[model samples]
Target: MSKKNLQARDISWLSFNARVLQEANDPTVPLKQRIRFLGIHSNNLDEFFRVRVATLRRMIELGGKKGNMHLEDNPQAILDQIQMTVLQQQNEFNRIWEDILKQLNKEKVYLTNEQNLNKEQQEFVKNFFDESVRANIIPLLIESLPQLPYLRDKSIYLGVVMRKTASAYDQKYSLIEIPSKVVGRFVQLPSPPGEHHIILLEDVIRFNLPYIFSYFGYDHFDAHIFKVTKDAEIDIDNDVSTSFVQKIEKGLKNRRKGKPVRFLYDKEMDAGLLEYLIRRLNLSRRDNIIPGGRIHNFRHFMDFPDVFKAQKKERVPFTHPDLQKAQRVTEVILQKDVMLHLPYHSFGSVIDLLREAAMDPDVTTIKITAYRLAPASRVINALINAARNGKEVVVMLELRARFDEENNLEWKEVLEEEGVKVLIGVANLKVHAKLCVIKKKQGTRIIQYGFVSTGNLNEKTARVYADHCLLTSNRSVMADINRIFKYLENPKTTIQHLRNCNTLLVCPNAMRKRLIAMIDREIKTAKTKKTAKIYIKLNSLSDELLINKLYEAATAGVELNIIVRSIFCPKTDQRRFKQPIHAVSIIDEYLEHARVLIFHNGGKEKMYISSADWMVRNLDHRIEAAVPILQPAIQKELKDIINIQLADNVKARWLDDELSNNYVISGDEKKIRSQIETYQYLYQKTGKHSEASSH
Candidate 1:
């Protein structure tokens, strides 16, 4: 928790990314999954640079003093460390790609280039390029334009240099942005039955470059792939005259012209063209001008063809045992609390809960929080329908969800037009709690019941992200939910309204104080040599004060077992501690997105499912919720799930002091692949995935 023991968040993120790279490097993984891992790693690094590294650079420009830029002790040192670490990772990435490519060749899955195309494939490529790609592209003659065209983020371009062999004066430079966004990135060519031939979209264009510039009559042509990353952190001005919506729109527009943070180019690019680009883009060698392989935007490979005969079918989420037979999800929740584990349980149940509430004549009101939505969000549709059906609906949509501002902003207008009262939440605090409250009138009284989740309501993510949602009608929990919504409905009201949430831990109000108090109890128990235990599962753990609290408990000989997916900053190398702290990270097919806190209060266990990660942002600057699980069955089930992850010997890696992501190996114990084992466990409990549900 001290500055000496804290791992830089940016540095820790890259180390976490190295775990993704290891997935690509592992030979045990299927070839397609390994390739996807590479794409995921590439995408993660891009965001890290655009957000975290870019922030650090701006801090350096503004004179990075202590207590500035998220209170990091040193910004320049972290940036330097990032450069060295990224370079080393890039080399490893290239090496892994070479190995994957070799494996692909053995499977007769060839990524054919323009020069390596067969006679039939060559004809196919040229025709496909002319038919689909030519019209979408407008090649800009670099020499003719007074200034270079604005380079779009998340795009790749083919920097072209054309010339006639005999006349050096006739040479000219042009730039063509690869129309991958318009057309697909991977082009499957005509191939024999057992052989799969695919080519990159850039290569197809490269093969027909002469035809594109036929008007100029160039004989020699060279094209190389290149891309650039820009600072994606949007800055909203504090001008009192403009509305928040106007500021967000303006910030989005200015984001396109953000300062270039990294410029990546093919290592084999011509010196003349490369130099011209650097000069035009105002980039220096000191900038992150990385020299990479032929392909620049390999992130597109995430959707690479399923041409390879798949060895494993993707996991299918099943219906929860409690809801598999219930015609009404609300009915089941009203009887007893239910825990829904996502990506293993059908997200349809959540949607069903909302849809039933929308149509139910007894339902009187609905209040929910929205941080992210799928492209076609059924949750939104249900809420809109509820408003049309004469039920009062309130959506506390967070407009500041990073990278989702535009989408959330668009949804805000739609909801407002449909008569849904949309609250953008209080200033300086993002409403991140995934909560819903649905009220229904029975006889004379209106009763409240709904759900609290660890992930977004987006159905798309629920199919992949591992999260927990508690469907409960607990009166105390519903009261706290209403209290929180009341606070959000009017921020100008006194802050005392949020203090009434006794059943739930509300961040920026009571979460921090309550968490520390719980830890203090464990520390006291440890000092007394009584049974003391704490189990924590979160996506990140970076709050220095809270981490130091954990360190204090560890120093008192408490048995601490922590499972964190990313950005953990604990030094578990203390000799004075009575027990070795078990800090591990589990990275697998599904993201570990749930947050749980369990404390052994003497003998009785206290369990909670929360939406907040133990980070400075979550605890200090965000609206989050932590709900206690009172159902004995649900508590035991949640404990069973966390134990599976703790016992994982395959994907879980020890979070050692050196940041070495060494896998936790079991010498003789049964191999428990938690994701698969979780599915089996749930299937046995519900008979799910064996037959269709009657609902």
Candidate 2:
């Protein structure tokens, strides 16, 4: 387990995804949730192909994986490993789907197709198709046209082969785009009172293929599902002649027509049609052509109909005690720091803080950074309202957030139109720091308070993404925030401002150095036989320098704990090390998205909630922030959450050398599902606080 022999980034990601597949395969999970896990795995793999695999392919195409020092593995080797891993996972996925369907049958639920429908159900489906789907779908004759229609990425299509009954040579091929986004994917049909019947949108189209091509008078038809995943990495060149916004706009268009990274189709699809598609698309074996089940896009299954009976009590998110009945979120923050743990804590306080600033006449300025936003975002609405109220509102909205670029661009337009000063931020370094600072005037005194979060301020994701947002009026923190924003506004002239920040770790050139210094201290303390421990929770930890530092600390006998959600590259189980590190990953109902690091400084404990993971890109190429937890109460609360996760035996999986993804078995011990227990732990506190406030 030398640091030099670290896991390949792509291979590590595939292992992470294998954990997700394990969730889908677990029989202990609720049936609906299991199905959703399948969808999540599918969606995750699609993105993996589009980004990571796509990048590897490009590297291979540009000669060999030689000059690129960033690549952890040879491109060809990683690509081959990916294909093997993905095919194995796909087999498991199909098996899980079959098992789930059987379970659904036990519940008197049936997923019907064109051939299986009865008279009434058939009529219902046909009517539903005519009324809703037909208008939305456009069938393209594939071979008849000189060139194929540009297939929309992530959308499923019904690859059709129509033949005249008398002549096999007179067959035609066409593609019908499934109108799932507009019409819907799963359509319910008339059935017996005790039984439920659902038909896929593609099957409905398949039933009416003859009618769709009535002009051609085709009698026989064979249709199957297929989808294309194109390279999603947008290339923004350093061309001074074009504006940054213009460059992004151009990149977006090019992204749409990006070289195909993967083409997945039903295994039952006709050999002729599949070959035709491969030829037209000019796909090589490197393109990752995969044959899967009838369903090409299970992601829509995430929105599966709620027809099944409830199997477990649904958990509810309670309001945080600090902001429960507060008159003003700003007022509370001014008095003391308030840490809001997301999903377990309602995100209303964030909106309230902004809304209060928007309406408060004394509020003079508001500054925030946005990476991803929810549709019809209350955050944006508050910002726009704040701008309208004559406050100096500034937003550093990163329009380069992948998959969110289009929406962010639209958000940029609205914010600019509403008179909000928008900064796109320094190119090559995406502004990813989740920060907000609001300044108010009170009788010639200026005061500032806002929140710093580990996740996006997106209201939608806030309901499911586990994160921490600290609302505070710490003067030093406010000073550092302003300094970072100043640097962002004028990076060329004022990069030194960020370097001077005393309270916050600003990334690109600062955080990495600080973290390394901290790790060095831990190693020194461990060598002296004094107590030393480092606990970290991050989305990923792939930076070579940091991983090697952790290894050095591990060899020095410093206790280490790491909970990474994805792309972990370190070798934690080396026998040469003095101690085995505790590393686990939890994939439960709530996404574990927070990044916290704790360093036991001999006796004095230091903890920080960061906007950056240990990934090289975040540390060296992105604007990130990490703020110290000065409040003892907030620090202890974070420690409690981390300890709970560490003790979790139910959902946590060992990040061992084998990547076997074995559950931390709770044999003869009390079972602890950290997500549920954490919710209860925080929620019960709300009642106690309410009683105290009333008294």
Candidate 3:
């Protein structure tokens, strides 16, 4: 088999999601965490449709079979495949839900519907609905409307069927969106004796169906949960007059009414009602009609209330010993290059550095890039404070960061109000680089101190995302970073000064060429029969050009290993490449999001920590940076961590040429989980508390 006969990237992504479903079904997983895994799987599918599937659908509509040769079939056929896989997964998901419900009941937690609720629970749900949900209900009569109402994307709705006793055939259909945003989907019901009880808001409405329509004189009522997932790809109009911010805001509103890409309905829904919905909503079989469980929007499980005892939740993770051992972050960074690995490491070190910069008298300017930030971002607050403290603060805020547009917009307004100069990203490119540079004056010398990360500056995510932040004062790299910021400040300015940047790889300029050259160097060394290898860790690897180059290198006998968390599109089947290219994915408790590349340049190894992935969007359409690891100690540390992940057989799954995610099985050997073991390694190195207690 050749590399040309690989599965489509979208299909490969669905396979990855199937692995997530596998986690949900794995009995070894804790009960509550399995429910959370279901949520993650659902959320990932939603985005898969919003971006990848939606893009393919448009391509098929515009160019027919001639457009997308990467796909062996039409968009309709691909969607059919997706729907079939989703339906199967939905069945598995339903079974998992049933098992979880049984487990919850064993733990004295009962999830009851209107039909199963006891008298006390029924009374409590009815009263609670009247107080919290009734006021928010907005019913739409389907028969009287000139056109069907536009349904919000990814929101649950109750498809209500109202029957009249006078005529058996005259049944009026209505739609009422469960006001989950205003009132939560789950409502706690009064416990009976020693058992805890909860009911969904849909059930609460189901119990009061007669009261909702008593004035209309209808008694026969049935409601089934359904949801529509529309295309969330924002289409910014090419209007020169509209500012970028205005365009983004308009695009966001337009995204609400974007083309419907998917429609998920309850499996037990009436056939007639399903047909009615498909007709009214102008949906076709190609629109991915998935038959799901009774409930939709399980993504909200991320916030599932811990009403049960605290013991039911996973234990709190200890802060990373490296960051915790630092007496003062800036002082420690100045003394030695400190590498902070997130989730294991507290993001507090970054926050503490910002706070120090905000108050330091010698600090003259603070420049940073914001891609995705938390709602209550301490990073933003620190920058705002620095601006107020008479220091120059510039924030390159990317407003087009997918689902984070609104939060970024809110922070943009707040930062501007506090006199911070905000740059709304480059024209057609997103500034996805996680960089912060603080300029301070010390005895007539201007010193630069900052860190670049592979993940967002959001502290909330930092607690659950495995990322790396490099705090450095390297002169050449700092000078290159300064020039990059200058170009961002004025894109029209010529970047002649950046031509000398050998320490950093700036994307859309030299990253691709530099990376290819590095690979070629490995190939040359391998041809000469010297030990040559390449190890890469990234979020995605889908760029055809890069993959082809990697294939060429592998054919040249360069050993290659990759740890890709999602979306891998390379086939390593040919005897030329053989088993030399090994790819694995690790889906652990924390999101593996760091981008690290290590190259064996003969005997002298070169390592780089990058903000860019091996994807075209990150290389050609984003302002990204990849800085070299000049510090020998930090280099060895990163190498050791990657080695640990490579040895992981517990959470790692091999990505084969068939794209069949097969778990890397360890037969009778000691199991190694990279995340847990990495923490242990760092704990040992930093000489903080005993590892046994931390685990």
Candidate 4:
């Protein structure tokens, strides 16, 4: 498909997020999960505005000097379309939230705000505010201040309109930062047996507004929530004098002063106060000034209280069958390759491998790459332990992992303090690949083994993110991993080492070309009237060249199966193709995060699990890896899982030409939910059965 015909990636992403909203509106979904879906949608939109929308604004500012950036349409036009879509989604979001509120009320659970509090609840809120919230709040009397204080991004503020009881015209405007970060956003209130009352932290402060400004003798108070989303793009200056770490720190500090791209508020906010606040923030009508329901930051609702009457039965991850009998994860992986389908297979094994390497006397070195890690990362702890155990531990931590920059900077210090060598990755390129290799001496011969994963080394996200990690002792794979690390260690001198990777496809050097070449081979086969097929699964698929190649293959009669979770751009239903590509997107309880590519290569099947998606940044800019799945059993397992997803009828949606996320039709076929089916597929391999498997 041509650039004009292909879907705009940003617009397609909004469609993907709409799928998230669909989940929130899905009555079949558990109530708690539905609420969490709302949170996910809100959080997703926040990042979209901060990054994607912010970039478009920059393009508009650049005017005629749009540079070499390939935009599908005019920036202003896209922004207008984005505004229209977002406003529509906001209405749908409000409706879903209202329905959820009614559901909560039916369960005798109340999300009571300041106005709806009963006598006992009012007294309870007053006491709670005085004891817990009073100290954290600092009300800004904006009418008197020379300039407004910096409005923090990702934080909600209560715009207060205070007036004398007797004088209707005399009023003062003030702002109070909701201390949601320090004191959490949700507070559980005391209630009678079999009933629950919950209050937002902002409401607690709202109830005591009179007490907060009592010295001024304010009698009437109206407080509504508003949030500002700032441009999150970090601009690192080129200064030979400043170190990379210093540059990163400076960039982070500058991010706080970024221009506002979005201003969202409760629609019922005081009209005058809203106008004053917007004017002071310098946001114009052209900006994403959105009005919504009472709740502004629904992202916090992801952790809504566990007070539902019907409890969800949590699925416990089980050990991989190959590792079930082995005393050590290291030993099993050393014997044969094992692929871990996360959330189905326990992540503890990945952690255990590092822990074992840390304590093993034969182990001499451990090298790993980290992009985003858990808050309390056991992987980091294990590396630190290895360092303390006299093993050389090298960690290539990407300091520019988008929103995790500050956290990674703090981690760099902790790791360096523990004697672990920390590498902040190559300049202008993020080390997006998840790779690790451990060297151990066995009778004067070195044995290397580790893993390459499609997800972050985060224990917290592992329970929900669907990902793949392959633990192997394969010599070629390990050698390629080591070469990539060598390139990372000294990119200026070791660029050839990255270029020489043979077994694995390394990006910025080979993956994109290799992928295109593979597509050409399939096309050739299809033209010769052979059975040619390609299967792909990725979080995104928007790179132009690859899409064009896939279009070519489709024209040559190549059978394609595409399972993309988000941000798809290809026109799958073009008229010239022999058959339309079988494309589906699955959004369910678990996040579909793994990247897999399969080619029929004239019936000699080839498979790979990758850390990179088919996006321009991932293919040509970032350092990435895609390792071949050589083990037959593991390849079959991966194929089976992909097939299960392709056959899904419950949660899967068709990615048609219109970008309409319609549910996949089951017709006469039996029902299949991929995540649940995947669990059963793996669990049955262990020669065991459970209620969860049947779920």
For TM-score, the strongest prediction is 4
lDDT of 3 by residue, 1-695 (tens): 34455556777788888888877777777667778888999899888888877887887776655532344346666767777777777887889889888888897988788999878877887788789989999888887889889898868889988888888887888899999889987777778677778888888998988889888887798799998888887888889999999999999999998888889898888778899999988998768888877888898876666666554323234554545656667777666677787776678878899999999999999999999887788998899889999999999999999988988899899999999999998777888888888899989789898988899999998888889989877777778888878888987666554455667898888999999999999989888888889999998898878898888888888889899998888887677773458889998778899999999998789999999998878888888999899888889989999999999988899988776778998899998988778877876665654434212
lDDT of every predicted structure (CA atoms): 0.90, 0.88, 0.83, 0.93
Clashes of each: 0, 0, 0, 0
Model 1 ranges with Cα > 4 A deviation? 65-68, 312-314, 687-695
lDDT of 4 by residue, 163-213 (tens): 998999889999999999899999998898999999999988888998899
Give the Å shift of residue 330 in candidate 1: 1.1
Greater-lDDT candidate between 2 and 4: 4
Query: Candidate 4: deviation at residue 160, Å?
Result: 0.2
The digit string of per-residue lDDT tens for model 2 on 1-695 reads 34355878778888888888888888878778888898899899989999998888878777755543355446888889899999999999999899999998998989988999989887887788788888998889888798878999979999999999899799889999998988888988888998889999999999999889999888999999999999998988779999999999999999999989899999999999999999999898767899988887998888888888865456656677877778888888899999999988889889989999999999999999999999989999999999999999999999899899989899999999999999886967888999999999989899998878999999999988999999999999999999989988887786888888898898897899999999999999999998889999999988889998998999999999999998888877887689988899998878899999999987789899999999878998889999899888898999999999999888899998877888999799998888877877787787742111100
CA deviation > 4 Å runs, candidate 2: 1-4, 64-69, 688-695
- Residue-by-residue lDDT tens digits, candidate 1, 1-695: 46887778888888899999998999988888899989999998888878988898888877756432475667888888888899999999999999999999999999989999889999999899879999999999988889999999899999999999889888899899888988999999999989999999999999999889998889999899899899998888889999878888888889899999999999999899999999999997768889999987778888889988756456688888888788789999889999999988999999999999999999999999999999999999999999999999999999889889999999999999999999987878889999999999999998889999999999998988999999999999999999999999988877777898999999888999999999999999999999999999999998989888888989998899999988988888777677778999988888899999999999798999999999888998999999999999988899998899899999899998899999999999988778777777777897534442210
What RMSD value applies to candidate 3?
2.4
Of models 1 and 2, which has the larger lDDT? 1
Q: Please give the distance, in angstroms, between residue 198's alpha carbon in candidate 3 and its true position after superposition.
A: 1.8
Q: Could you tell me the TM-score of candidate 4?
A: 0.99
TM values, all candidates: 0.97, 0.97, 0.95, 0.99
lDDT of 1 at 162: 98
What is candidate 2's local distance difference test score?
0.88
TM-score-best of 1 and 3: 1
